[model samples]
Target: MVSRRQLIGAGAALVGAAAWSRTSAMGLPEAPTMDSAATQVPPVPSQGPHYNPVVTLNGWSLPFRMNNGVKEFHLVAEPVEREMGEGMTAYLWGYNGQSPGPTIECVEGDRVRIFVSNKLPEHTTVHWHGMILPCGMDGVTGLTQPPIPSGKTFVYEFDAKKSGTFMYHPHGDEMVQMAMGMMGFFVIHPKDPNFMPVDRDFVFLLSAYDIDPGTYVPRVMEMTDFNLWAINSRVFPDVAPLVVRKDDRVRIRVGNLTMTNHPIHMHGYDFEVTCTDGGWVRPEARWPEVTIDIPVGAMRAYEFDAVYEGDWALHCHKSHHTMNAMGHEIPTFIGMDKTKVAKKIRQVQPDYMPMGTKGMADMAEMSMPLPDNTIPMMTGWGQFGSLEMGGMFTVVKVREGIEKGSYEDPGEYRHPPGTVAYEWTGALPEAPSAPAGSADGSSLRPAGKSASAAQADHSGHE
Candidate 1:
């Protein structure tokens, strides 16, 4: 006795449910929009000629500006929603509001001072990631200092000690916070500066996300099956394509803060791992690696001398992390053809089959009940160790330019094709509270014994 409209609506709901299920299966949400005011923050000053100011992301600030005397520069980062399809909402932590955050350009050795203000309720801190700095300025809460509580401000002051691609992110409760999308890139130029730089330099802050809306609590990682991964906060196709000209010296700054070590593979040329967390390593440390293995809590700098130009897939070595999960939300059939629709209906719910299922084609019209036990153990093979962390990974597209081939178009080309990019989603989980025993559990000690006994038991653990 179902009316035609009711039947059609039910079908649409089914489809929507299916899509949502798939997104869930992927361990990520369908692209999110800037939902809570907790995620939003004030804007940074534009990077213009003769003037550059310190900036903040998600609440952490650092020193920014050029010392090499470069006249023109651009600093862009913003918050943006990850688009799933049309109406779906997926939010991410981004620079200028974009996932990978913004690409910051400055001369090497410049005295940089950036002021960061946190808008999110959770405590957050910004780690220079791979940049070398004094122990006090390293940004590690307790280690370097204390956590920057919510709604507070902190300033990161340091010299751009070396020239290479670097990054920034929250060091506290990194596993959770980073997985939620709080990370970005920091680029330092060489003092002399090589004008031979390519027509474009792209920075990509790679990461992963566990998007089960049911598992949104901070600190506690739901051991759910994660299937969705992204480059600059986007899956393939949805993510803007990287465009580039031939023969340009493309510099890619990649940082891996996810729990896993991303062995980033490039298509065309061999790249040099020019720098590490301690700044420029000795010549012996510099080596040519095609697929550079960037461990979690670390960064890698590489420059590719662009030779040929074509579209190539740059992604993490982990197979499962690349695609969306099998069940994010409920599946939808809004755009499917009639025949396919009939087949799907029969496959999913044959009992509801009817002679004419045409109107029920669009899955957008329906809403199905979400499933239970969807959350899975977030820890496994690639879980515990810093490098194998689930979320951090990205892509870099190296393209040909006028130097190697024909000049097609001409413009400011601020963001050249194949340029690396990312957006920050939000704060990660807070670190686990101190374990039982020690003064505040903040200090490490043996179990089952008093702090003094544990301390006396073993000094090696510390």
Candidate 2:
């Protein structure tokens, strides 16, 4: 595979000006926003929360300062210790001390001034992944402006004109910085609560890393093979589940920064692709969907009414994305008789044990030793058995009596009797006879000569 650096260096000359015009917001539709505020100290237009804030696990929304009617937020780009899962951490570069950084929340028409202080070992620049802004504020390092040098601070002032789900990340190093987990979600809530009102709103960025076991830092140069897939810099079972009340309208805004696309699949109910980083889709333009594919550097918002009362799964459709610490070069052992060889090898080496003789599903249940501070290739245990899942996997639990805006863990769902899968407990019934023409005494052979004569003729033949 061509390295990202080589692609950037070569593609830069051919797609530079054309790429900016096509990608960096030329004819974006204006985002929709609310027009009124009802419950507040004085009913401020863009003040006080308009809707119930979505909980970002291991992250929070950036608090802004009211500086003479202009909202101000400070983003410090520095090194951070990000927890990918239980017993696993990576040394990554992030904004505001979080791998995914803090969620930047604003309203349409709000004048925002963000101060970004760079403390990294090298220069960097923040790119608004899907925002309509001035060319100078677009944050392309060489095209729009010079890179922000280390130890220096840069300020980006712009009006929050569009209301939708968006993201921010380094546009300077492009490959290295992004691969190191430097990204965050930027949400501009609609000004009109009635426009896109939902009982609950959630946001997270889909990111991937290539951090090997026993290593503290990620390999930022890796572009294709990623061992650690995460949602908001966390893997399961460390990732939190989406909890909602029955009949509640929920919005899940997902942004993808990984090298590949992710078809995010949700079970039990169909949702609508109501919005994107570009803008909100019109009601008539929206369609029901169970899975939405989010491409690299793009964001998608899925909204649906939570009607099912169970623990439904939500994960990346790519099977490999649902695993961790996988070895791409592991030899396949299918159909191989390794039992005898394994026993002989075990006599010499006590730890020798052949695996994958049947399939890899057994790895989920095997109590094998792993490196310290590392997760297994696939690890998630449930009431049934091992979940056999790892990265980019989470559950959406809807119950009957959850408090409004409360995200308390509802625990595992208890299935009703006869609903759970189990072994057969009743007496076995007799199977039916074989069909006609079958070899199980259902058909007869042609008879020509006596059996003894045919046996004697064959016995004398060579």
Candidate 3:
């Protein structure tokens, strides 16, 4: 965690630095800021009901100070520069120096005091989504409480009444704020330590941005055709993998903040949804699934036993969601003969070339020049070769003998002899042909076994 005062030495806002210094002197809780986007350890809960902390994928947990018996937390809502991928960055509005701000962890029935200091240019309100609280503490701007105006701080005091998956985001001018990436996961664990325990717990928020190719900001008004589908504001190859020990019971919680729905699919396991934003599903009521469709503005949590030792693919089932910038506009050119077209066009421009005639997979392998700050539509490479994937995609690496609580990537998995898929080099036998087709190009009925003839034969026997 980076302190705001430390940033001032590097020539940041001086007045804000003095203000934060005074704010600390005034007995206010510290607003811990995150400077790194890599996965960090969930801080050990100093004092609270015993519960396992969740690992925030590509994010961190906001630390709190215990004031008397209440958990006190200070959050500064301000503008931040978020790295969308390796070479792409977006200026967004978030809390404590990062978008989809730190996960707030609490126990059910705990009295929590959150101090939200508005550093944004406009007034904002922090709405606690999917949590039961006092009407006045609901964080609605006009209906419940006044907005926290720019440069002012407001406090929300409430008891976390339920334990389940929830979220927090700006309710004032939400369309603009949330579109600019103002959101975070809020998890209230069950008071009972035995309840819903898992070996490895992970949480992330699903968000989309319409950052045009080579641009730094998302189009806030654009409702659909979003090009950057992300998990925790980072796209694939950059989004860290979930490393787990073989046979560990894992629980993954996902909140959907995107405008559209996502059918999240994971290979090599059929898991059951154990909880949702509403509440925990009864064990008897749960059913098995390999793909869970998370609806807009909702959350779903699923659990599975990682018994298989391998790297499994986990991504949105929608093909385009697995691609990067401007994925929706590309036209299909499969099997088209563009040789003549390329020859004719190259006469005028000597460097002219045609692509996609064979398929879009060629795009992934091409070294074609791209605009500055733009990531390829389909990217990532695997041990085998080009992965041909992007956006909302990551791998689950399950390995044997991984130490407990270690989340580091274990590198690529080493397949056992005869366990991996290999290309076929054996000779092929005579291919079987379908029984001769009729003049209409439909296959003829099997010899002496037409449906009508069978019915007639049965009638004669009767």
Error of 2 at 254 (Å): 0.7
What lDDT tens digits, residue by residue, belong to model 1 across residues 1-462? Answer: 222123224544212434444544443222222222111221222332222212211121221232233222222222345442222235654433345554555666666655555555577777877677777788887788888787666666777777776777778876656666777767666666443245444455565566653333222273445545556554442343344565665555566666667788776568777667567656676788778887877777676666655445466776556444334444454445567667778888875433224432222223333333121112112112212222223223444334432222332224546664556589988888676564666356445678677666566556
* Positional deviation of residue 21's Cα in model 3 after best superposition, in angstroms: 15
Q: Judge candidate 3 at residue 425 and give its lDDT.
A: 94
Better of 1 and 2 by TM-score: 2
Q: Give the TM-score of candidate 2.
A: 0.82
Worst ten in a row by lDDT for model 1: 375-384
How accurate locally, in lDDT, is each candidate? 0.50, 0.78, 0.87
Which candidate leads in lDDT?
A: 3
lDDT of 1: 0.50
Best by TM-score: 3
| TM-score of predicted structure 3 | 0.89
Total clashing pairs for each candidate: 104, 5, 0
| lDDT per residue (tens digit) for residues 369-461 in model 2 | 889778888889887889989999999999989998577779999887888768999999997755646664333223576656655675687
TM-score of each: 0.55, 0.82, 0.89
Query: For model 2, what is the error of residue 90's alpha carbon versus the real structure, in angstroms, after optimal superposition?
Result: 0.6
CA shift at 32, candidate 1, in angstroms?
20
